[model samples]
Target: MKRTAAALAALSAIVLTSGLVPQAKAEEKKPYKIYLSNNFVGNDWRQQMLRIADTVVKKAPLAGRVDLKVENVETTTQAQINSLNNIIRTKPDAILIDVGSPTALNPTIEKACAAGILVITFDQVATADCAYKVESDWSMLPAVQAEWIAEKIGGKGKVFVDRGLAGAPISEQLQSGFEKVLKNYPGIEIVGYFNGNYALGPEQEGVASLLAAHPQVDAILTQGYGSGAIKALQDAGRPLVPVAGGGYNTASLVCAQTEGAQCILETNPAYLSAEALKLAVDILDGKEAKEKHVFVYGPFLSTDPQPSKLYPDVKMQKIEVGTNAFPDLAPGLSLPITPDWVEITPQEAAGS
Candidate 1:
């Protein structure tokens, strides 16, 4: 079985570049071909997802059992459709995709699955017929991270947000999460929310611009690339503002470890991917997979300096899971977690 799977992977890769054995003959083996369609490109988080996909492609214990192909095309609805159309043409045994929207991606996704292609989703997903999903509790965390920030700041101050892409679900969900928190504290005013577009240079520059615009910006809120925000804020010569955000990175963890920043709460999407892939393989092996979605529960919350500690639910004391995942305590910088705030710096978001 292992030999057959490996050969199939090699053969499938070859089939794409140069057709050998003819299409009819290639179909005879009915190989387990796997396609991974990643969402977004350029951001550290996106890169992390690709890194994990690469590791699985290279090192799955039954590597080559299926032909594994990967495509990362930034986060655009059209790109998603294009990948779907291409995968449909190939008619692979399975496709693992990171969705671009919860609602719009359904049509193409259903079309592929209706053609009998096995489908699974990671990162973000649509509401349609995904066989299963490997995702975190994204709908809840933005508020959780925000609530923490509000608590630390005593819920009374002006907060600026280095936001995410305008329409993406991550930006919306996390933004709402923070909004819910703000509702609890009427004293906290949102000064600005800039769509950072998940790029470090822009996110950082935006933070600098906001700092220049609002000298009294009490706290900065963001999701991904916040180092630039910190650099901008600190450069302006204000006392280091407390920051909070997410992503598992060495820089964020180092920030927490060094006590230079505030919070760096993050999720290990690799675990989510590993679990999701296991479900995909199980279906291939003719086992019962109970549901269409699976949620991985975790994120590193490194808060404050010496007072900061990992969440009680996830205590990784010696190894310290809360390391770079926090901002102010992240050895450097952080963000106030919000949904629409879709920028990040993933120095530690490892794939494998």
Candidate 2:
């Protein structure tokens, strides 16, 4: 028995010294490289979108599997084209784009596609035939709010129209939707039309200047910049009128506080970055999808339906405002729409 034990120990020693002992085989994971080509970072929504992408890429299952790089440039078509040209040369596995012009980037996008790189465009999308698009339905998003505004004013009142960036496809789509509804009500005079630029400060200033010139405004129709309009009205001591806007954190709270104020919050959530990233990852993983165009619809926030409230009888496309305006969330915080796979909380989004 002793000899057997000694021989076994000697064999073990020999195996260790000879490097015959098996070592753990480290996982050979090839990180999928992704590049984000953003046209602008001038607004809160755009910044939030980028942050969402960062968080999504760092989460489990994607943490070690993805290598993401983001590149931002001025909001010009030529700048974006130059950026795309430079990015294509790096030969990443996929490219996610937020463009300045719809058709300006088509040739470069086609070049990338031909080079075997997957190209996906989200908000501020391009008209590149070779690129996949992920975006919300712009027409439906504003039509519901426009209808609500018309309904609140009994189809006949002076209204102010706050537009987003001029020449932007989303801006044009939203305006078309709102105008289509407003056309049904000839009595609803459009008092003033100003470009809100989708930013709070610019919107506030523009609304304020318009208010100074036309103090008889009854309601405001806006694509974004709700909070700025709210403040402008408050500063002017004008009676709060029904306002409609794209999603704004501060606007949601302000609307909740105003006595006679009625507003609609239907925004394209910022987590769309995650959606774009998800598409890139899926494609890299060889997941097949039938359609290249992805459409996300906006959710209409119904108001608190209380008979005592000034705007209690309002409804948006049959979606009634629920019991709480901002349930389980603080005021002035943007809502984040995330799928289970992305795993992001609104608080995390807010903080970021």
Candidate 3:
């Protein structure tokens, strides 16, 4: 009897230990599957954005936690929708979209949300209520820049405005913001408007044509690279005027190097993709976001630095060579290249 009791106790101990091992295995969290659906890859910004997303998944904290897949589609809303439908069928844990159209992707995004897939639209975001949005505070960029331009030119001048890419939601928003700020200063006149199309060639051509027509232009508001506007001014033999443009490496460098240039550059950073990925991982890990829409703000880089009355909260950094402006890097490299949490070097961000 004593021997049998001892054997039964030993068997119980083994059973208990075996049961605990599977319980611990069951508690181990599996890596979540995440997909990035990029609508356009034609421009340098889009390329860099995609690169940043790819880099994030391979780095610490996110490396072992996410299985990221990127799907670049034709620059059409329908193409993205079709691709998203296919991705939905695969049932990924999350989907991040740099949407082509804001309203057109609502239904598809809703479908994904219904299927329990977290949908996050960054950069050019969608209007789907169910999906979360991660974007630069678009309203702040134009408002502050326009204010700077207004102040720089003594609250009045003939300003040229770049309408940005045609039919893009961000373009419309930026245009509206510019107009809204400039309206307060009755002396400021928007002498000319052109579609920069968010490219160097188009921006240069458009600005050059505008400069020819409006010889007395005082300032320029560019939605993309400011370098194009500076080049246009130089080509036309027009003196460099105070210009507000996007935060591109070339834009800051050109603005800093040009003898008479007075410029302010603001960024919608490409690290937004990485931020979206991080948000997705957080959600998947059961950390509920306090708000559905998350706005990531980048720095305001300027040649003549001053506090913004409109957006005082926004950080304004002096555009210094080798700091914000990299002379050695590619022209189209976006500014504020590295996010605070990640250490993405200039070469990596430039895709060198």
Candidate 4:
């Protein structure tokens, strides 16, 4: 009887030990090596990019199952091309390139793919081929901004575009959207000129030259900070110009509150990163996807009668892009599309 009881106890212990070992092995998942290639680092957008990297690392289900290698190559196209080439030699499982032109980066992407490395795109999308594409429809910003302006300016005004670079995708797509909206309201006269250098100096100079070209500029519509237009307006004693921009941010919040600018729209960038990371992980996990262009999302729209309310403490503007456009994810590092704007009202400016 004593031997039988001892044997039963030993058998139970063995089963328990075996179960725990498998559990421990499952918990101690292997790490995944992911390479991230960043194209531009000096802009406000890039700050969000870094935040996205951090968010993905913290939020991914695989957690320790993934490792990151990040590299930024200023804004030079050649630098991006070279840096990506070098990273490819390391043969990471996946790489995300925040690019400006898809075609220019296509050859390199092809080589990386040939090496069995999955590639994805974010931010300034390259014209190159990749496994996934994540970003807001850049083509939509121009029309979206124009739509907001048309609503504000009552569908008729002489507006000048402080656009992005002449032929750049951002500039081109935004311009196309704006043009589409313009056709709807022929009363809205486009006082053309000004490129989005995405730099303060070029942005400012572009607006300055624009003011010179079109003295009767009713309102200035731009892509970046819109600092140039504002400076030109203020320096020239131009009372107020109703301007709308996509990169609506804290400074824009301050400027809007002080009646420096008008409507500012912000599309949260973290969503882009999270989406890009999600896809990258999927590809790494040996899953097969049918398409390459995987669009994550864009911004949310927040409108406060007084843009000043955002001063001191800013929060994500709840965008009304509809709930159906989202995917299911757990709490914590969940990225929401808060791409809305709080317009500095005409009354606010009038008082200022």
Candidate 5:
């Protein structure tokens, strides 16, 4: 699995020289083959992430130079490991995967690395030493959310914790971070904990059932189903409470419109898949990456006047503050990616 530095340096020179020379003088460039392996397509966020991965290769720099393939299977370690082994057999120049387990797929990933294939993992990553990882600040975001919720409720209240899908690395990290912060605020009582699964329908149903039994909740801390929590409260004929949520845009917009209902939005964008694609392409082209791991932080948006400097281009439809919430969009819409990060155009988004 280990690549000799001298061999890598020689290949780097060839790639750089090929790019610099005139088309007529340059050697005929063969299209670099890449494969994307997704563990599941359970939610809207997953669907969007796959779309962005497919769309990125059809654009500039990679347009005519890369042949990309995509595959999805059940979210199981064995399933993903099988997929990785098969992809390695195909001998693609690179493979990008959203893994199902942190350590289960490491040995398989090493096999691919030993075959001289560049591997990059995003979303949920493998523990392979050879693979590069690209993801957001999973730890900081949830901790920030927990701290904000505690402060909003005066450090003491009955709070409902809406967790994401079980067994997911990101979900575990977010939950751990949230729990760590809650420990500091002993006055804040966690009345109930439920897994929303990060989808709208299931989340709404779970919140509804919880509301029926415990209607006196003061605040709700949701992983990625804020809109569902809002709808659950509305259906129960109960007033809205201060909630920390992410992913969906409608909940934040609705919160802005409703009087005295405080909300904060921080979504992990699907476009990060495109960034993963870019990183893979760069490495295959023999461009040495400065860092093996990259951490992108999701921008925070709230109903209050947020820091104007962080998100300069972010235009809010109702609150007139931060990014992530758009009232102009229909209900159940995911937060739109920044124009600078558009791998797919508006036409593709509409068609998808």
Candidate 6:
């Protein structure tokens, strides 16, 4: 009996000493319940963002760690608020929002925070102090591209600026960035402004209308796909010029293929959802963020090698076929598809 007891005790001590107990405990930890609340799904960017989030939760690091539920509401502040109210009742471990209005969701977000639910807003983030924000640095997107345009056009040219979507905070922010950079270059003249609304049809129409009015446009600073501007210039029989726009796959491909086209495409990556998911898991696992606002700055894609003085630290990669820009993919697909942590193929990103 003494020998048997001694052997059992020895075996138990070996298991504990070998760290097997802790490892088993860690493996047994339950996955966190996370909810993604999105307001709009009208554009390719928003759709891609949702797809990326779905892909992320099924991959490693997040695959077994998160039980993610996506709740997409109508493109209205009130609709999102209503959806959030229902989400709050479920009391998931965390709630991630892509806000329709920055401040309109504050009251609802506060209610979520009050109930001890972690709230994280990304992309079009909210203004709730209690909710953490993970978003692209909007100021950099326009500033770097604007600086490149000023240099490409030799600091003097008639430039058309896209005002983006009406009444959107990001639109104003981008417009502000563009103006702030161009103000330094006295020779550069912003002759026309249009509402691109971040859609191809509106962007093309807006640019075409501007082209008809301004006979001497030297460059275009578009807030959406640069392809629309290219098509507008082509249809108007005007010479292809330098353009600064968003990093859409078609835009980069068009810039590369079109002769005499000088372009800079900035990315607001869809992987931000993945980032938010990771952050929620980290916080749930007892890791605290140093700051409430987590700023993710994407790469500056250029058709030609045009370095920036304003943003020296930013990654500026030359757009290439089958690399940064895929020719076989959908036009509306966002570029730089995969985040660094995971390997999401272009097919997966494009939902092919």
- For residue 324, model 6's alpha carbon misses the true position, in angstroms, by 1.6
All models, RMSD in angstroms: 10.4, 6.0, 2.8, 9.4, 8.9, 2.7
Cα TM-score of candidate 1: 0.76
lDDT value, candidate 6, whole model: 0.90
List model 5 lDDT by residue over 56-103, tens digit each. Answer: 778876676678889898888899888889899999999989999889
Model 2 clashing residue pairs (backbone): 102-127, 302-321, 303-321
lDDT of each: 0.64, 0.77, 0.91, 0.62, 0.77, 0.90
For this target, which candidate reaches the highest lDDT against the unseen true structure?
Answer: 3
After superposing all C-alphas onto the true structure, candidate 2 shows an RMSD in angstroms of 6.0
Regions of model 1 farther than 4 Å from truth: 1-31, 248-250, 257-260, 268-272, 305-352
Which structure among the candidates has the greatest TM-score?
3
Candidate 5 similarity to native, TM-score: 0.85
Better lDDT candidate (1, 6): 6
Ranking by TM-score: 3, 6, 5, 2, 1, 4
lDDT of 2 by residue, 87-147 (tens): 8999999999988878878899999999999999998788888899998777566766777
Tell how far residue 169 is off in model 5, in angstroms: 1.1
Write the residue-wise lDDT of candidate 3 on 110-205 in tens digits: 999999999999999999999999999989999999999999999988999999988889999999999999999999999899999899999999
Q: Give stretches of model 3 more than 4 Å off.
A: 1-28
- Runs in model 2 deviating more than 4 A are 1-28, 304-333
Model 2 C-alpha lDDT versus the unseen true structure: 0.77
How big is the RMSD of model 6? Answer: 2.7
TM-score per candidate, chains pooled: 0.76, 0.84, 0.93, 0.74, 0.85, 0.92
Candidate 5 CA-lDDT value: 0.77
- Residues forming the 10-long window of minimal summed lDDT in candidate 5: 308-317
Candidate 2 similarity to native, TM-score: 0.84
